[model samples]
Target: MGQIIIFLVLLGLGYFFGRMAESRHYKRIHQREQAYRKLLVMPEKIPPLEFSQHESTLVSGNVVISVDYFKTVAAGLRSIFGGRVAAYESLLDRARREAILRMQEEAKAKGADAIYNLKFETARIGQNAGQSLGSVEVLAYGTALIPTPDMRAERIARNNLVQGK
Candidate 1:
């Protein structure tokens, strides 16, 4: 019957649109994950006289601080439906990597070969608290070691001789 064909077509269209919307939301999350991988860092504090004079001969590393947010919003919307959404895994993974990379760059800029004492934390903003929009923020820092000012000068001279140009 023509009615049956029309009904089937309508059903097919609905399924297609639903799939598209779901995929679009997921794609946006993926893009966020990618952008999250690009670590953004600020800078180190200018130490006073003592911090400047201390020679960093021991082993240590920079610190990375991060928060994971995924459950609060999902909990809010899940009550309206019969199921829960598993979307936070990728988000958390991406956030962790972002924090590490940021700290790594900071340590490298400070001439530190390694890092230690890394840590993490988490908190939830309730849906009613106006902070459950599903965003994670990470802050990382570390004590970096630079060569002695004299050694730096000598190293530069050695490099200048190698090229001889």
Candidate 2:
């Protein structure tokens, strides 16, 4: 009985703290997302015609998020019943969004006009990953398109100058 009581208390504490931390993290993510909204990110293999002549470089970001104690306990209970483990949904969402944000930051820093061929890779991390709850690693990758002066526009300007018109 005493052990059960202690476990319950720990679970309550975990739930309370986990919620607070997740809320704060979500707020931060939202702010960063708004700030980086202008940085175009796309999953299409081919860039738009405007970016056809742009330089390309690989950019990636990865984040490992650990499940809180409460989430682990809740997920274990949910697994026994055989249904969706909603407890871990937020965890994955946060990890994926963070990874994308980081990738966007990298592209912006490199003066990229846009990111193309966006891709995601996720994996379970930490000890005993298969047997128990563990951290999840989310990786976001894409090709950044850095703009160069448009060759067509340059040619037109050169011709105009040559013709003095």
Tens-place lDDT per residue, model 2, 44-84, is 99999988888999999999999888999999899899899
lDDT of each: 0.49, 0.92
lDDT of 1 at 10: 68
For model 1, the stretches where C-alpha displacement exceeds 4 angstroms are 1-86, 108-114, 125-133
> For residue 28, what is the lDDT in candidate 2?
99
Which ten contiguous residues of candidate 2 have the minimum total lDDT?
Answer: 125-134
Q: What tens-digit string does per-residue lDDT give for candidate 1 at 1-165?
A: 999898667666655664465456557546654653433222434434434543443222222222223244344567568464554444455555555565655555665534443554434333345744345554444444445777677778999999894
User: lDDT (0-100) at residue 160 of candidate 2?
Assistant: 100
Error of 2 at 75 (Å): 0.5
- Candidate 1 residue 32 Cα shift, in angstroms, is 16
* Residue 2 lDDT (model 1): 100
